[model samples]
Target: AQSVTQPDIHITVSEGASLELRCNYSYGATPYLFWYVQSPGQGLQLLLKYFSGDTLVQGIKGFEAEFKRSQSSFNLRKPSVHWSDAAEYFCAVGAFNQAGTALIFGKGTTLSVSS
Candidate 1:
């Protein structure tokens, strides 16, 4: 079985401060990991993903994540936080094998930006 864990259920950060959202996963084989952000009443948008290649992958919206295979973690980071960055972040994992293509998502972490 595969799963994603977001230790922080909610996070509040002052504007301009750096941000780090934690995520951990458990999978039998190499995993396809992704981070998605969804604003209030909006569709989820992909923040970043790791299939293969460099462990550190840059994503949209000034975000990046590093995939650590040994630790089974893929944590998202942003150098600076903005008001618009407030949203629900989800960490997901996918499989491309015969089992089927479906993403298993974490409960999600809500980010609050303070002025």
Candidate 2:
């Protein structure tokens, strides 16, 4: 079965520090990869995605992700972190065969920005 895993359950980064949230997926074929962020009591917001074409995909809020087929990973990165960027980050995988089915999400990584 296809699944996503976030190695870090929680990360604490100082304000303006670099951030990297790891995401790894297990699937027979290359599946759709997505990064989502959710604030407290808020809905999930799309950060970036890797469908095809480019191995490195840019996303909203100074975020970018690189798709490494060899690693089966689509890791999200940001050069500088912000306090507002603190949220629960989710790595998700969607199958091409199952169009209507919901994506498989990782447990989630909670980001805490420290001053």
lDDT for residue 23 in candidate 2, whole number 0-100: 96
Model 1 C-alpha lDDT per residue in residues 1-115, reported as the tens digit of each score: 9999999999999999999999999999999999999999999999999999999999999999999999999999999999999999999999879667899999999999999
Instruction: Name the regions of candidate 1 deviating beyond 4 angstroms.
Output: none
lDDT against the true structure, each candidate = 0.97, 0.95
Candidate 1: lDDT of 36? 100
lDDT of 2 at 10: 100
How many collisions per candidate?
Answer: 0, 0
TM-score of 1: 0.97
